[model samples]
Target chain A: MIRTAISAMLLASAAPALAEIHSVAPGEGAQERLQEALILAEPGDEIVLAAGRYELTDGLSLDVDGVTVRGAGMDGTVLDFTTQAGAGEGLLVTSDNVTLRDFAMENPKGDGIKSKGADNIVYYRIRVTWTRGPHPENGAYAIYPVESTGVLVDGVKVTGASDAGIYVGQSDRITVRNSIAEANVAGIEIENSRNALVEHNIATRNTGGILVFDLPDLPVMGGGNVIVANNLVVANDTANFAPPGNIVAGVRRGTGIMVMANEDVLIENNILSGNPTAPVMVIAYVQPYDDERYNPLPRGVVVGQNTFDGGGYDPQLEGGEMLKAAFGGELPPVMWDGLGSLYVTGDAPGWSLNLTEQGKGLGAAQPAPLAAPAPEAEFDRTGIGAPAELEARLSR
Target chain B: MKFGTASLLAASLLLAGTVIARATPPPEQYVNDAAIMDGGLPRLLSDYGFFADAPAQEPVPEVHPYRLNTPLYSDGADKFRFIYRPAGAQISASGEGLLDIPVGSALIKTFAFGEGKDRRLIETRVLLHRADGWLALPYLWNEEQTDARLAVAGARIDLTTPRGEAISYRVPNKNQCKECHGLDREVVPIGPKARNLSGDWLEQMVAAGHIDRMPQGADRLPLWEHRGKSSVEDAARAYLDVNCAHCHRPGATASNSGLDLRWEQDDARALGIMKRPTAAGRGAGNLLFDVVPGDPDASILLHRMIVNEPGVAMPELGKATVDEEGVEAVRKWIAGMEPR
Candidate 1:
């Protein structure tokens, strides 16, 4: 009993504490108020927001580090900017060590949530929506992280983007986990960045899903990212078939994720399933053939241990033949419902294709500051971990 | 009286000569096939209307074998290719149907085509070479077969000169055959199936009194093997409706804003271009003006319909499984539409 008490004290000492905010609504220049609080805040100050919609035509950028702005609930604190009467982003951040929870940063004339040069950012139970209830058009990205570092996107729901949902570009030491991105041109785009940990994120119903892209022959080289244990895709099976041009043109390719000329990327412990066409795609456009002259061409992508669920060209239509003729022998299938290890159907009871890290050393990694030496395992998946006890503990 | 007769005869002779020269041969001013289909893949899909159920050209087969023989024996021309069009058009090929794919993989067809010793085999592979996925071609990016068995087969490729000289290219080992009938990415349009009946091929025959418009609504005569709803003309229209409607609608890339390309055309205001927005991106398909009040030449759509850039072709579907005559049909229609 004495040892247990002493260990608890030690445990408390190792962790940075949390701050909490109760209520702040309308008449509160919520902007000015937030700014003031941030200035007064130290490390781990929590600003719990009241249930209401906050509009910032010019948006708000966090000034302090280690400050968190939380909401009462994900669906409750609605921040809309689609028809925003301003010309700036909804919310932009420049400080690191910030945590946001139970809030929805939505619809901006510019980017939804633009984090510039920030890092170690975490969002808990946050829903960033650009879809206008049912009619969304050109609703840009949900979480836009550019030139930042150490971003942790947790339990965040994002949708409806003209471009991408969770766009991480030119960043490092990042982990985007336990989030949902759908109805965007591209979902979870990691471009010209490095050292990212992408897992437990569900990207569906877009022209292209989670992508690691670099324009070959261009000066930029996006490399060295780890995409472990995330559901990178789904078929854009929709009952709502709007008019042909409802969702704009140029967005048609659907998939779970992609690795385009990105080197040293790890795609493990994830389920890539039910994409209308391909689950994961790797594209490398080189010089001479491609018009854009690259100073240096893109190469090196190592894909392994991930399950590519049932996906492929529509067999009912005529796309199958075209697919085969283009890739030569590389064109295999667009679907994999039973390739066991990595893929699972959401329709299945309790996610039939769960992760099997039974004998591995990483002990079922979470989306925290994932520091580890990954074991040389044979398979990788895009499925999230369901550590019930841990989840329960974290929620509390 | 004799002078009048001579003058009349001379005028008639001059008219006949002009017509003969125009019909004789294509001028050297014509470029190659590589200059026709450019842009990217999305344009190809939109231009063709790939999703909407339209009448099929071929009669519906009573039974389709799980494993087809068409893609299996390429007669030495066994490879996959990607054909792209300007933004929002594409045709993809993979390892199924004609070529056996791995199981859950796909490849986007490009100008640089793929070749395989065995189109249907999925294991023990070697990637020998890579080509420009976006090579220029006339009509839809053009390629052909050059293998012995296929040459022996009855695959007819007609090569003709302006002087009516004919050379038949063999369809044994060349580009994948299903180009005209696209294999992936929504629908296939802009390919070889279009080579015939373009310009005056069918029209000249009709004008020569070989055929006439039926007194009824449409002449439901059997043409090729493909089958579905509607007459041949209606089916062709349906093919256009399904393959191109997506982008041709208002506020889309193909949208002259006020010009709808669905089954029922939309008014100019409905199509969006009372004053169209400038194409936003640098490499965008937003060609400035499509209907310069009355001039089709001033129209961006017309310019795109007959393109030469691999990066900006209209109906970007390269000849993955079909042909370029389909694009010609669209071009003919676009050239003839009267402004509202």
Candidate 2:
């Protein structure tokens, strides 16, 4: 009886169908194998992968609706693109109602798992990794889902990447649950997405944890997210794990949450303790003045009722004198409030208003040119070797 | 870069380095000052404060007499050991407030002068409901500063929703009011002196037959009815008679934080720091969410219950007892301090 009930629950919870991958044996030619699989894949048809490693030369695109490609396991099946040159989008899935589960797609010259213009394309138990050697000219992303909808990523593990562990962009009705995203420049970043739910996931020991950002001017603005619950969002202590350049210096200093231009996003009931610097950060939303993707808001954000305990360190200072010294000789004060508990929602009146002409609910207007004091042409070689002696000192 | 001699030498050196690294202690590995001084301050205060305020102070005429006239609330069908009765038990600074409160409830014990030098006031514990839920009077006194009080503005109420789910809320005001007052299932409010009846003037009145004896203690005075978290209602009685009876019972600190947590043991109406959270800032709730019924560890109030940091810690006075054992006791008390 117990077995029957368990099976019934599994059946009820299990998605409509299984996603499979086409076989790419070690002895087979990589091009023929992938091309043949792409040709045979129809809408909703799965191509199951057999155990072995296959090296790719050019990028592969699957634009069919409901087409799924799955693998044996991350370590079991390897899509090695070590020798590929100028390849585009390693495993591109651009269709709706599709699913990709249990796979390893590694070291592409371009986006690791890039999917565009699709809906309900779920990726489950997928492991996307990189090779240390020949480190393809560009093996950047682990899993990149852009301009998609209803993307649920569960039990997926990503490792050793220069970019986000899982980057989901401009989608709605998405859920990323029970996954481990660590050791990447940024883990589980949601850019221009709405109504996204991130729960039961361990996003710890990463460069950055769960960021809700809006990349404006690209015709996208994120709003209404639920960073409902999770734990152990600590500092990315690994030195080599730091992002190239000061890609994110101030508001992005090791935050469990980096809240940008968004609204009505609830960050509640999560253990936001422990992180070298801040466990939570609410960055200034100044569009076209500071950041390129700033959508200056009419209202502020909510920093509500969450407990913050330790991992105590904040290099950023509130006093004008301190900020000047930290960011060269003279710079605008980037002091953030509403950190400890119960910060306001929708444009805190306490903070200075940075309203745009359009933000006054006037007719639409062009986004101001990014006034970000131009990024450094050459990113300084990150201190990839110096481990923070301070980080080694903290723990509870 | 080679495959033989140079690589072998580098690998050997790396191995040797690993071995040497393990052999020596890093600078941080050595014992630091923090390791030794952690539980120091909080410990001495608890010990020193306990002794100085023990039946040792000059006896006041009458502290909290309600504990002598009330019956201890027993948990059963109703779930709560007590019930609430508004207007039945009320007190204020003007000395013109309602009395005749039933046993087992918490009430408002506001204090301030109507116009007299008679500074000492009545013990408070019966409860009432208004825009805020059940309000309590929490005023803790340090041994060194008896006149000083750490009163809080908070509300405590019991609400059974239309769905038949009973929810208790304790809205905290400006300060971290939930901390020190929280112990047992109910916040163990500090009495006028030490957390007992020997220090109360009302108990003296009861001893002198001015009022009826509450169903508690060896002499039915309200203190001896202690049974850990179970009989904390009596403890709650002992709490109010001394703490709020002086100030909030009539006149005191602007009713600092505007909360009165004094429920007579006889009345046992749920008191201060017990009610639903209120929205403070623009959509920001003053109470941390996730106060699920039956599970105290997940409650945000429990966090304040165990916390001891300055602005975040409870009582906001005399720093909580920080001995590993004492802190643990506080933690255990808070973890168990869910609405009974």
Candidate 3:
């Protein structure tokens, strides 16, 4: 401890302007002490939390820009909010250029580690869990970053969220990679966002895995330019436990790599296994919206090469038994609602509902074998991830 | 930078004139300008000297009391509001927007329960306008009601609210204060918008020379006490503007929800009329739209307001119990709407 403090002092003196470390430990008054450090921290300061369980009551927040809040490790330093009394989230970050890593929050009454309107934020090596596993009353989102530019969520694990785990909404230049989203309603959902790169994430045991969507009547609209690649999407057949009135409550249980109401989306290089429903589902927004600015179609979506194994064995469609029997005891891998511009490459067997327009129910479907054309050109790969400068903060 | 320097020089010149005109030594009622301008956090509420008698909730000389047309409900706790401007500084107005108080000003609000001899101060929330921006802090009152101390992470008091419900009243933490006061990534004052301030109070400030003139949109919101004399829509909109607009407007905390309830917003969709929920997870309560015309029970906007749970509640902070009166006003307005 003495050596660490001495080195921190040396670093502070060397910089003379930035790099001040405020170290806090868990004990009585841990809530006040840690929250005070977060509130009073200056720009470029680091608030280091020692390894222990912080039994906090209310929510904590950090609004100082360019600050770093680090803990010993995800398991070593746990922020236990089992008795959280008030506030919307366990930890709220409303400032820019903030880095939070190596910590865990358990059983918050609301969300866990929400960063709203906080730009260039990096959340690394963090873990958020309900501890009681899947339940309807769990917080909405874990590791949520919304309405921000340049968001990077790397090496995080989220479980038992009633809504999406690692949910990024209405943001641009985002990357969510090297994460584990398990037992949540929707694992790793990118909604109402643009220029996102979701790669190399392990998404399993959730209701749906890796959803790229665009909903209407949001401040930031027209979500597109997404790349969902190189991930493990398997066994996402968990029953949807989302609360009533949530949009995620409508998600099918065994969906994998679904895209809705978006354009220029590329889904490729994923390992899909053990998913009972369709391995890849592409469709449009089903709800009728009054916003004129909204186009409820998935245009220019490309489904590339992926390894599908043992999926669609027990389908969750409207007529599962008849459809599966007609398809030789197991349904095809890809399922489309037949309302969008979908292109598939490399000859993946699939089927389509052949819906005529948006907001049509299953009664309007004419189910048939899917036939889609190859893409005219390669998918655009420009500016499709978090800014490269965000990775530098993780190294520190 | 140049404007700041010039303003400082002008303020100092005005201060010199006041010093020369004074007959006796300035009383101890003077506000501590250093405390407001200091970068360090004041440990105790008394350190800022905002109140002459901290227990009695009495303000110092430059601290002036003001009342809004319709006030926000905080578990029915009676609020004492005050605005403190430096002796030489001046406040300017801009239509119905926020009054541009000088950088050294502060807004102080104290929450108390009970009346007369039974009154007990619960907490005090202060907004200090430093050079950088507004800084909000919460202070928890002691059991003796002598002075409140800074509760940086906030505290919960197991006390009975005005409605006789035994509840844990929450004192919002420093960052939670920013949740309601934040605008466009900056902490700002939310209550002193010109439309919400009473017209008589504006004219009084103008007569006192603290303000240049009465703002254009002064006294537009329906008065809370006289809501029966006004339209139900005006009363409900005033209640929502006072309570929800701080976070629901554009560039605020709930701005991503696409519901802007500010008084000046005339568009029906922008006001959450038949607008679908965006990020209102379980708060939507199985309702389809935010405001369902002619169906108060089906409106998600009213549904969130009446609930007191953490994740499901609107305003998300500073409220524990249902504001039944506020709910009734909104219910009447929604019920009166013409259904499409």
Per-residue lDDT of model 1, residues B1-340, tens digit only: 2243234334433432343345334222221122223223221211322112111101011100011111111112222222112222222222111221121111222111122221121111111111222221111222322111111111334443222334332221111111222122112222212111122322332242222311221222212123233343443343444455445553332332224544445444333222222221111233444444444454555454454332223343221122234444444444555654
How does chain B of model 1 score on TM-score? 0.29
Q: Give Cα-based local distance difference scores for all models.
A: 0.41, 0.42, 0.87
- CA deviation > 4 Å runs, candidate 1: A1-23, A35-44, A133-137, A216-220, A237-252, A286-298, A315-321, A324-331, A334-396, B1-340
Which scores better on lDDT, 2 or 3? 3
**Candidate 2 lDDT over residue span A1-396, tens digit each:** 653554465467654243233455555465545645664454545677777787765455565676667677777877776654322356666557666777777766555777655566677778876655212122445777765656777778876555566877656666777788776656677766776777777776665677766544333454544454554465543332332221222234456666665654555545654454445544433323222444544123444445555432443334435433544543321113322212433221122212234323212322121122212232222321112331221110
Ranking by TM-score: 3, 1, 2
What residue runs in model 2 are displaced by over 4 Å at the alpha carbon?
A: A1-24, A133-138, A238-253, A286-294, A298-300, A304-307, A314-396, B1-340
Q: Candidate 3 at A38: error in angstroms?
A: 1.0
Docking class of 1: incorrect
- Chain B TM, cand. 3: 0.91
All candidates' TM-scores? Answer: 0.42, 0.41, 0.92
DockQ of the candidate models in sequence: 0.01, 0.00, 0.51
Full candidate order by DockQ, most accurate first: 3, 1, 2
TM-score for chain B of each model, two decimals: 0.29, 0.29, 0.91
